[model samples]
Target: MLYWFLKWVAIGPLLRVIFRPKAYGVDHVPAEGPAILASNHLSYADWLFMPLTLPRRVTFVAKAEYFTTPGIKGWFQKKFFSGAGQVPIDRSGADAAEGAMKSAMKILAAGELFGIYPEGTRSHDGKLYRGKTGVARLALESGAPVIPCAVVGTDVVAPTGKVFGQWTRPVVRFGPPLDFSRYEGMSNDRYILRSITDEIMYEVMRLSEQEYVDMYASKAKELTKAAKEPVEPSDATSSAKKAS
Candidate 1:
């Protein structure tokens, strides 16, 4: 299959040689059966390096745009993403979040590893942000143990904007599986979901040793972009006129 070929022959081998990612607690990964690999999304390479370090295939719920772009670059992106065990789902509709959860749940029901970034998006400032509760919902719905994962130094390897950049050895650490069996059947409870998500993120913070930001990563990016935008002279004039 394309996955094996890419993993053993094409990309994975090359990445391992170049980046030389060092992974710890790989044994914590279940040798078989279903589980959630919930990780901090540091950079685009987080998906690549994490799976490259594991023998078991990890299926990530990726955005449909990764597979639907037009052009030669789009072709390659689709191929590479597919080869990396990514499944694309339309993440724009109102049910987008539920759609992603269904895809992951299907993978878990079939007794496979489901990888997810609970942070929803990569951290722009390298601080671990508050995780979305979808991951907790997945764990509860599928009755799978959640393993907290920390991928360090990947941001240096492939930063936010650049496709590839300065090489830095990344380290991946897998914390013990978290069991939320006590909170079974409480997936519909928003408070319970928040608590479960926060607990998993706490473990991820300990493993990655990164600063924790209570806000969501996407919100932080929006705030940063807004702050950087120049105040237009037209807007300034309009404000002055209103004051007058």
Candidate 2:
């Protein structure tokens, strides 16, 4: 299969040589069975390094747009991601969410390792952000234990918004799996979903030791962008006058 070939024969070997990834608590992963690996989103390399730490494949739900990109680069991206076993989903609207859950449930039903970034998006400033409830929803729906994972040094290796960065030793730490079977059949309960998501994020934060930001990563990025935007001279002068 393409995933195994690329992982064992191709890209995997090359990356290990370059980045020298290290992993801890790998024993926490179940030897066999369905489980969810919920990790903090720090950089693009998080996906790359996390897989290198495990024997079994960790399938993440990727944006459908990545597979549909136009041009040669898009083609390469599509091939690489597909070969890496990423599932593409629209990631829009409630319908898209439903579709993603179905896709994930299918993987779990087959007793596969499913990877998810509970933060929903990569952190812009390397701080852990609020996790989305989709992770909880998936766990509750699939009856899979959620394993909290912390990925370190990936932000430096492949920062968000940049193609790539300097090679660095990345570390992935897998924590004990969190079980939510007590909340069985309560996936529709929003409060329970939020509670479960927060519990998972707390373990990730403890492992990664990154500063906690209560806002979603996407919102944080938006606020950061807005803060960085240049203010017009007219607006500045108006503000100065108003202050006077």
Candidate 3:
């Protein structure tokens, strides 16, 4: 009840105006039942903005920190995020993945919309990367369908920097849900999970139209940074001018 109140009466109205997000293939989202929204993650704005564009209340498994800050602001943040139906998962280490998937399965089993970014984290370079298998495992375990999604232009809105940066009109495209019903009875097969996971990632790549790297986007980002590094100058600018 609190979630829908904010979704329609408050946050939804405000974000629709501020972000003015554009959406495609919205009809692909099932009006009922459990479905997963799998997309390429490009910016922090993806979380706040994507749900605003959807008709149904979509829940994300958020990092526990969003709920644990100290004092009034923290109190407000926790309530706001919770009222929006977010699931809190500890993201401190290896256990974080296990914890997040556990929550994801719970949401899906309840016949609700579960939104996940299979790339795992925000894409530093705005490109589609290999997806983790958790999405597949969740769907297979819970008998849910996967809706591939793509969000564009938000990276520019909130790029990595001191500045919050400026808002650019963003576009979110929801591609049709690709059914993995073939794996319905074969959930125990790891190969089936991998195949289904890859299928979803392929659709995401097409929708986002980002450069596809076989490696995780996070790793590609590291290589990208390494390759673009500026060489140190042979003549050190740091040294004071010679007192000749």
Q: Which candidate wins on lDDT?
A: 1
Cα lDDT over the full model 1? 0.92
Per-residue lDDT of 103-214 in model 3, one digit per residue for the tens?
Answer: 8887887889999999888887666788888899888877788999998888887775425767788888898887777778777788887888899999998898888877
RMSD to the true structure for each prediction, in A, is 2.9, 2.9, 4.5
Q: TM-score of every model?
A: 0.90, 0.89, 0.84
Error of 2 at 93 (Å): 8.8
* Collision count for each candidate, in order: 0, 0, 0
By descending TM-score, how would the candidates be arranged?
Answer: 1, 2, 3
Give the range of the ten consecutive residues with the poorest summed lDDT in model 1: 87-96
Candidate scoring better on TM-score of 1 and 2: 1
Q: Give the TM-score of candidate 2.
A: 0.89
Top model number, TM-score = 1
| Candidate 2 global CA lDDT score | 0.90
Shift of residue 156 alpha carbon in model 2, Å:
0.9
The TM-score of predicted model 3 comes to 0.84
The runs of at least 3 residues in candidate 1 whose Cα sits more than 4 Å from the true structure, single-residue gaps closed, are: 68-77, 90-94, 232-244
